[model samples]
Target: MKIATILGTRPEIIKMAPIIDEISKRNIDQIVLHTGQHYDEEMSDTFFRDLDIRTPDYNIQVGSGTHGKQTGLMMKGIEKVLLDEKPDIVLVQGDTNAVLAGALVASKLHIAIGHVEAGLRSFDMTMPEEINRRAADVCSTMYFIPTAESAINLLAEGYSRKNLFITGNTVVDACFRHLKIAKKRGIKEKSLKELNIDKMDNILTLTMHRAENVDVKERVVGIIEALKELDDADIIFPIHPRTKNTLEKFGLFDELNNLEHVHIIKPLGYLDFLLLTSASTLILTDSGGLQEEAITLSVPSLTLRYNTERPETVTAGGNILVGSDREAIVSNARKILDNKNFADKMKNAINPYGQGDSAKLTVDAIEDYHARGLLDIVAPEDIMNSFKRKMKNIREDISVKDFERKENALVHMVFDGKNMQFPTDELNLNGMVINYDKRE
Candidate 1:
């Protein structure tokens, strides 16, 4: 089956790279659609080159704008592309306008949709990403949840039990792959030394790109004030162009004007950022990807947003939710600094994000879902076994007859965010299996 993968932002592009790579190795036809949500040629091109992903088969050129306008433009442009491509499924990753647009178009066009990074909820509705994720989740044919927590979130939303797959987070998968490649070539270590920083120093990595944080004067000031707390610490901020523009517009540029130590530089490519994250002491950000990346890198973070859809990071102890409140941000930072036990707990905490193989797991889930439909590869007994393994975390006995003709085949896997739900009431959550199919 042909899969058209849609991506618009830098993080989505990075996360999708591994899935695209996995899919191609299987000899499946893959179409890459770039919505141009991010317009920086230097930043965008670096991802394709550094990550070794193919250039887009189609470019929509739907550059930046208000949320409604960008989403609308993507919807129109992506809809036209879908009409021309007519692929079996559309894949989208993370929560971005491109994902919502691609999923909406595919759903309206009667094509199946697969959402990577599905079922993340911050319970805060003000953020556009939360809205985009909710919309995509409602429409997806397959939900590739990055964590068991995310899958639980989907089940709470009343999604289908059959469609949800608790695949590990693809970001971790992609990050580890690039880091591994870099280490194999002796590049990861070199990349860190180039930055004039060591892994031992206390570091606070920061990233902010959302319009809500950048476009408004209050939010911008709040961010600047919090960032100022790191004036004494080694604060590394690889900033996006939009964040720079917002800073300039709000007169927040003077905060870093001729500053000696606050390293505010152009955005780093996927591999460079991964290396930086790997060596950093802590993270401070508004970006969802950074929140997840903190967990992947085993670093602690303080989210600048008041509410988050990805609560797993906080519960996993990888991050703290400080939002934009200036005093609160400063106090929280100080508290975390003084609390060595808390810091060690986070540093040594289990990586709730996923191990390094999430991309492969996500690919396997999509392949199985498709194979079961087309070839009847999963018989009743196999289905029971699969369900037992997925829900109970226990291996179930499968009769030989169940797999007499079943064969796992090579398949291309792409990650996308579109609405897809799988509902299971039997799954025990926190010792309470109360009916959760209606809460999402």
Candidate 2:
């Protein structure tokens, strides 16, 4: 089966690397498409190179712009490609404009859509990513939920159980795999040497690029003030280009430059950043990906955002919601520095994301669907309603609670041409496969 994997941002590239690698191993026909949402080589190309991802077959070159303008441009560009390629499935990850555009265009063109990292909601409509993710979920034929919580959220939203699969988050796969590669390559010592920093006992890492925190003068200044208060350890601040531009626009760049004990560096490549994060005493960021990454690395993190969709990290004590408040950020940093027991406790907490086999599970699900001729199913109104009815009957037969908790449960349903059968009681504990004897 032909698959079009669409991605734009660095996080999507990193998270999708494992799935792409798995697809290659299976000898599937795959096309990598880059939307160019993030145009900078440092932000985009470096990740693909470090991760050894295949070069994209098509690049839309839709760089930074207003949300409406960017999404509109991506839609136009992506639609053209979909018309030409006509792949069996278009796979997108996370909530970037590229994911939304790809899902929308694929849905309109009668192609199947798969949304990886699906069923995440911060419940804040004001955040553009929240809108993108919700819309993508609505358009997708298959929802690959990252966690059980995400699966519950999607089911609560009336999503069909047949379409929902609890494939764990791919970030765990990326972090675990890339960290091993970085260690073997001796990137840790190289990064420290290039940055002119010693291999210190304690290093505080900072990465803040979200517009909510950096675009406003007061917020940016407040975060700098908070970082200034963190004087007990060596602080490494990797300044994103957008954050640098915002700082300059706000006239706070000079103030940030004047701060001692803070080593302000340019944004790091994937390997260097991985090495730095793995060695950090504590991490402070507004990035959603970093929250999960810290959990995998066993590094304590202080989230600069007020709310996070990845609350499992917070529950695991691997992260704290400090927001942009100076006092809160400083206090949280101090807690990590002073309370070693608390830090150790957080480091040992369960990482709820998943093991590093997410990519394998995702690919296995895809292969299963393709081999069963389910990848051609379009998520039109009547078709979706039928799937929903099937799900409801299944729920009645076996409670949703039990189904979700059952580790060995097999979902059995058959589709032939445009027709489907929901024989809810056909298969028992013998693990028989649901046969689709007829196909058009």
RMSD (CA, Å), each prediction: 8.3, 7.1
* Model 2 regions lying over 4 Å from their true place: 43-47, 186-198, 378-440
Model 2's alpha-carbon lDDT is: 0.80
CA deviation > 4 Å runs, candidate 1: 43-46, 66-69, 181-195, 215-231, 248-251, 335-339, 374-440
What is the TM-score of each predicted model, taking all chains together?
0.78, 0.84
Position 390, candidate 2: lDDT: 24
User: In angstroms, how far off is 212's CA in candidate 2?
Assistant: 1.1
Clashing residue pairs found in predicted model 2: none
* Overall lDDT per candidate, in order of appearance: 0.72, 0.80
Best candidate, TM-score-wise?
Answer: 2
Superposed by TM-score, candidate 2 places the C-alpha of residue 142 at a distance from the truth, in angstroms, of 0.9
What is the per-residue lDDT of model 2 for residues 144-168, given as tens digits with 9 covering 90 to 100?
8787677767756766567777778
Locate the minimum summed-lDDT window of 10 residues in model 2.
431-440
Candidate that would win on lDDT: 2
